[model samples]
Target: MTQVPTGETVTAAEFRLFKTRSFSRHFNRTLHISVYEIHRDHSNRQPELTLLDHESIQAGDEGWLVFDVTAASNHWLLNAKYNAGLRLYVENDEGQSIDPSLAGILGRRAPRSKQPFMVTFFQANRNQIRSTRAVKQLKKRQQKKHSDLPHPNKLPGVFDHVHVPDGRQVCKRHELYVSFRDLGWLDWVIAPQGYSAFYCEGECSFPLDSCMNATNHAILQSLVHLMKPESVPKACCAPTKLSATSVLYYDNNNNVILKKHRNMVVKSCGCH
Candidate 1:
């Protein structure tokens, strides 16, 4: 039901389930989630199962059902012994005989696009980029030091700060044209090799204007921050609006598939 955070590095994990063509009750189904790990239970030799997050979703349309599993993924990264994957169970309402959600698209028979997948984001080390020509030009121009190395404070629902205090810079969107071919993804992606995804950047201060798309709660939070300072924080520049991107890539079966990846593109950004 919510979009995952895209941080400076791989600070988040998102589980995307392609829920377009599912054999189940479509209107409103309760999706229960859980993660599997290593367990030492004496009663049985089953893997350790830990519950994660759940939400109601409609499966009638061709879209992605995203889930935040950052903690689970981080745990796996920290210890390999506990990385057994996860499960999504759809509860049947009114005892309608919805059978075990063997409904999940699994095994080698499943289509690559329809099968569940995870999306991750990361960035280069600051020390690695300090010697680049771009860095030299930015240094020559004397751009703000913070812009080069930002330790963004994480915020809820796709919002993250640039670590620029007092919001001196204007909050605005930036152009980010992504080219699959340039990224050497031409082996898989077959059509519309690139797209302008754009992104939200810069800093925004209080008394946000019409362009900032400040919510009522954000306005109140700003006022509270001004009064108490430490109790609350200012809003961050983020994507207030987003759109899906249609990807034409090859599946595991070596078939060219065109699918719409939800929230794949950032359309318009605002201070939120």
Candidate 2:
């Protein structure tokens, strides 16, 4: 078994020896080995090695293995390489070991470009009542409403919304309305009513309902559209009035207490 330095190029014989001897137990398995290199252009650099499925390699193939390296290194490459290793591990399949030089062999492979960020244009009625206090009060009410809602068993709650055009058709008070059902419950609730329009950009996950905002809502909506239908609610609407309240309740010692006391209810549920 040969021990190659991190940044150094791995030779064919060295890789074979490492595979057949030091890593013999991983013969029919996958090994996640990091390849480090100092490239003048990071974009052009390739992963030092990749585990090739046995099906892709011929029975007696002993030469260098090749792979079509994707141009982008951000997400696709990361996820592909990760899942490739996982597949190798879980399936316990024989595979060809590719050296970094294979990147040059598979030249001019079709470059995988990133999907463009979806741009949405909608008429947003800029609140004529730009009182910061009013906005803050509304925000506080929204927060209270969210806080009062039942907690979901899942970390993130997924929902769907109809993309409506802004104009006389929509109300002025709210920006968007999302309809979502709580976990273990079938009833769907309309959230933060009386909004103009909702733009769903991509998928997102969050722990708390109060955390749902324009950015996250868009992401969650996107994810719901992409992955799981059950995660998303049947529909969403724009509400007219903020259903949350912001009032500080304090004990004699001046300790702030949240108004909706779920802990007390849980303790008294008598489920023991």
Most TM-score-accurate candidate:
1
* lDDT for residue 19 in candidate 1, whole number 0-100: 50
**For candidate 1, lDDT tens digit of each residue in 1-272?**
11222333345566665554455644235433333333333366665566666655433334445667767767765665766567555554442333323434343244532455554433334421111111011111212223222211211121232223333456777889999989999999997889998888865553344456555566556545433344577777888778998888899999889999888688777766
Off by over 4 Å in 2: 1-202, 213-272
- Computed on alpha carbons, the lDDT of every model, listed in order, comes to 0.52, 0.25
Worst lDDT run of 10 residues, candidate 2, spans: 263-272
| Residue 235 lDDT in candidate 1 | 75
Evaluated at residue 207, the lDDT of candidate 2 is: 18
Look at candidate 1 and tell me the lDDT of residue 55. Answer: 52
What is the alpha-carbon lDDT for the whole of candidate 1?
A: 0.52
Candidate 2 lDDT (Cα, 0 to 1)? 0.25
